[model samples]
Target: MDIVEFLSERISEDEAVARTLLGDRTVSKSGAWYEQRLLLECEAKRRLIRIVESARQAALAAMVSTPDQDVGWIPQSLQWMEQSLNALALPYYDHPDFDQDWFRT
Candidate 1:
């Protein structure tokens, strides 16, 4: 798949994982919960980075093989990948509250 499609799929998968981690709670309240959540997020980020890196390398390789005019898509794709990496750095959930259950049912 293309970089945009691949990143979109990864984003959806990450959101699903977040939902599973949160369960019935809108926000995690336990430190342990946050820790576990961070681990999952980190793993997701790693996967995203890997995909982006691969796409970037492939784009660079393609730029060498194809005609200059036809290779314009490479820069745009790289920009999109950069933006995605930036978005991934932002926090998705609120701080722990210490009032909810440590483990959701």
Candidate 2:
């Protein structure tokens, strides 16, 4: 899956976890709780971003080191990382007016 799909899935999973921890009624009942959850989700996204970037850099270095062989996957992987990073940079759940459909464009 592309970065957007990956991050979206991650966010959904995090939300599910939060729901389970706070219960459905309490999950959205308090601003402080919601903010805390959102911060946690953002931290997860940041970690994913770092991991993807590191992998992309490694692929790039490998591609450069072995120029003779077919390294087409390196470019594709870089593109995926770039897209995912872009998606992760968005306001996402950090904003009160966040919209899931905004990423569709």
Question: What is the per-residue lDDT of model 2 for residues 8-93, given as tens digits with 9 covering 90 to 100?
Answer: 66576666666566644544457547756676875787678769878988998999899999998888888777766766746544
Candidate 1: tens digits of C-alpha lDDT, residues 15-56: 666666666555547844774675576567778788887998
Per-candidate TM-scores read 0.52, 0.56
Note each model's CA RMSD in angstroms. Answer: 13.2, 8.5
Error of 2 at 40 (Å): 0.4
> How accurate locally, in lDDT, is each candidate?
0.60, 0.67
Off by over 4 Å in 1: 1-29, 90-105
Query: Which 10-residue window of candidate 1 scores lowest in summed lDDT?
Result: 96-105
The CA lDDT at 102 in model 1 is 17
Tell me how many clashing residue pairs each candidate has.
0, 0
**Candidate 1 accuracy as TM-score:** 0.52
After aligning candidate 2 to the native by TM-score, how far in Å is the CA of 62 from where it should be? 0.9
